[model samples]
Target chain A: MPAHSFRLLSLGIGIVKLLRSSDWLIVPGVLLLAFFFVAPTVEIALSSIFDEGLTGKHFERFATKGAYVEVFRRTLVRSVWIGILCVLIGYPIAYFIVHRSLRTQVFLMLLILVPLWTSILIRTYAWMVVLGREGIVNNALIWLGLIDKPLRMMFTTGAVYVAMIQILLPIAVIACYSAMTEIDRTLPRAAKVLGASPWKAFRHVFLPLSLEGALTSFVIVFMLSMGFFITPALVGGRKDAMLANVIAHNVEQLNWGFASALALLLLVATIIVIVVVRLLANRFVGVRSVGMAP
Target chain B: MSRKMGNPGSILLTAYTVAAIVFLFFPILIVIPMSFSGERFLGFPPKTLGLRWYMNYFSDANWIELTLRSLRVGLGSSILASVLGTLTALALARSQIPFKKAITALFAAPVVVPTVIIALGVFIFAVRSRINDSELTLIAAHATIALPFVVMIVGAAARQVDPTYEKAARVLGAGPVKAFYYTTFRALMPAVISAAIFSFFVSFDELIIALFVMSENHTLPIRIWSDLRFELDPTIAAISTLLIVFTTAAMIVADRLRRRSARKPDA
Candidate 1:
């Protein structure tokens, strides 16, 4: 054989030897993700910018259009609000569960997980039943002579918040509960023994330790709320459309470039928020550790 | 420390927890009885209860077909995810591969990224490649999301497994593959099974990707979505009830398997 063919044959043998190695187990997964996940992400980013050979028009339209900007603003603001609500409600539940006996804790966690594992669609459907005009709440109010007409509870911002909060509350509780469990149970008792009142012991010791987990839960809920498509689309009114809803609509319209732009925006915003939160958390944790040092 | 049972603060906290639990479960509680409503409409208290809607669901061909489609997609994606994820886990836990952290992060990227964004990317890829409306494309898309769960669960299990057992097998004249298959693989079976179950549900319960990619055929969630959009009937309530039951059963099984695996002795 010629030298070129011999070199090619040697390279083929080397490649086969590499694949036969145990370390090459990652090859199949990496290939799958590279094709499906990384390639498509790159495709989306490229498509967003390279419509008819590298134009900024798609993003420009998003920035210039008042309605689109409003949708983006609403998505961010609503997600933050939902995140706050989840933390407010979920923190107490987490605290309660953590304070319970082991058996009780297990039972409570099972309750939380059952709903967490249920489909978002089913949960949203249940909300529709409860909040609809002829639904449970309105029926109860009318039966009690509280109102002559059925209240239009469905397809409103309040409905959206209620449904979203209920859907995400379990996640917040789980995050906080897991964090709280990691705390040394004797710390608060030690604080009390150090002459701090019960509230002060909780406030000064227990609260700070669990705060990181609560923040994590908030961030998770916020990120999820930003990309919420089904719950908002199903229960939310016209004015309550999120960015994900708009992207879905644009995709259906066969406006791939515009949809990709919106998706890129959502992805970037989520990443920025997560990175900022991580930095803040690291600093807070660093400060706490330093303060606790003897 | 336990709170004093007679304290006003303790009583208030108890009440608050009770109320929160009620709020969390209220929607789920409402769905079951509404599923049994004898009337055409969905009302609370579900007057004149019967299995009218459940019967409707059982007899409907479209619902049945979509359900079967969901099962096939779920099974296909879960098996793919489990196999790939197990191999990836073994590589990360046992091998001296470079950039281990980055590779693990890459495997987990799907979970962090929003489903809608991934759905759009995959949707565009499918349409551009002329692969939309195919089961394989949908299965691949579902597997992408399910990959994270399998990797996380099985990776944790693989890490806990002592390397000595496999190394001992290697020293006893077994081939590397046989060493792993006999020692580590047997120990990892329960975890892999649980992870696969979780992966199956991840795909089964998924909707946004299915909705975006599927045009001619529909998965169960897609069917539920359209029915929700175009109509409001007791049939959806029935379907929701059934899904809740299925999810609960699967969760129980997964939890039991996970616990068993956690309790297993080292090989």
Candidate 2:
């Protein structure tokens, strides 16, 4: 080949190598997230300290405020309960579906996915209707001669738990069902054949196998509940307020530093819980079966 | 394996599942009737059956405007996120990126963390950047959240199939762009479509970020939020029922498309 042709061929090779590498395609997307997502997160973490020099004034305000402290405590406490409630409600449903025919499992899972796709606001509003004084629950009770007047069931702590669990229960079920379905149906059967009772077979074999999924589901539900604002704000009483509500209130008040502080606190709390779960689950069991994206 | 309807435990399990399903869907069922109620207050089993609230939602100029605005935002963010996220997914599937795990984690970060934190973060950042309330900022903010879903759906779709056709074309000395243009893109088209639809819903349904980042441009959820805060009306219920039907259809379609594509072999 001529010298100029050789040069052209080499240039062509370099271009192919670059194209074959292909990872450059990720830059535009990553850059967008870097500026918008990661940068904002960093700004939030720093905002509590970055207001007019490095000061903890924002966090200091949070720490000093009894109301703020109370909201954080309530958020943490309620989230744990929501997680437990979800699992208690979810496990049996998942176990039932897991034991069903493949077609039934698919159909049942689709039923669960319907409410999952529905809007959170609509779900919250539904609870308001059902639990309201003149809502169906109250109306039914009145008609049954159980009560002379409508009961005030809306705007209570129980209302919050009910709605939140309803909103989040599908997630727990799907997670656990996915894991439960992966277990060999014969393991528990084999245990039963070996003289263990049916209950013991499940406890010794099925429960141990499925618990990791339940734990993962719990973590997810718990994390999401901690950040919940809409359901709590819409259906909850003043006492039912979570940290997310407090953060939103602060944001609305144009108190950016304080809002950022509250957001950071919630984020830290979420991270801590997740890390603890990961450590415990990784050490103890088959949490790798968790269906959540890593 | 021994589960039977006659067994006490099995019967209890059956009842619990039924109750759980009711609990899951009860709110949705309650609102459907309320939306048709001629009554002004929020009560189910309407005293009179009519589409008064539905008519109100459709006829009201403000509601229509917010609906159009939300569609625009949803489409805009969907396109941006789908393109960006699809590219990232393809990149991850085909080649090595530096700190790929960390990069993927960052992409997924928005979904895991609370939306309030993200809203607060973006709000504070926007204030500093002076793009706090712009439509562009809102689109960018939503796309960031929706990006992860696109990546997730498309990444899963991309990983399921062999990319040998593209690789083979490359080895046969087809230009890199031309080979991919001809091969992988065609194969991944169904998943790409699914991802776009999913991304649209993610942005369309988002409210918290919009509440913090948007001021003049009110989305549908924002409108609903304002109304719910000020008054308990049947119109909100009407909107909810309509959205529930629409979203359920979208999800079913998306799921079917996903299953079809997963079953298809290199088509």
Task: Show model 1 residue runs off by greater than 4 Å.
Answer: A1-21, A284-294, B1-4, B173-175, B263-267
The Cα local distance difference test for each model comes to: 0.89, 0.86
Task: Kindly report the docking quality category of candidate 2.
Answer: medium
* Residue B205 in candidate 2, Cα distance off native in Å: 1.2
Candidate 2 stretches greater than 4 Å from native? A1-19, A283-294, B1-5, B169-178, B263-267
Candidate 2 clashing pairs? none
For candidate 1, lDDT tens digit of each residue in B1-267? 455687888888889988988998888888898898999887778778899999999899999999999999999999999999898888888776667788878998998899999999998888889998888998888888888888888887887788899899999999988998998999899889999999899999999999889988989999889889877878989989998998889888897777676664744
Q: For this target, which candidate reaches the highest lDDT against the unseen true structure?
A: 1
Tens digits of per-residue lDDT, candidate 1, A258-279, equal 9999999999988888888889
Supply DockQ values for each candidate.
0.69, 0.68
> What TM-score does chain A of each model score against the native chain A?
0.90, 0.89
Tell me the docking grade of candidate 1.
medium
User: Given candidate 2, what's the lDDT at residue B151?
Assistant: 90
lDDT of 1: 0.89
Q: How many steric overlaps are in each model, in order?
A: 0, 0
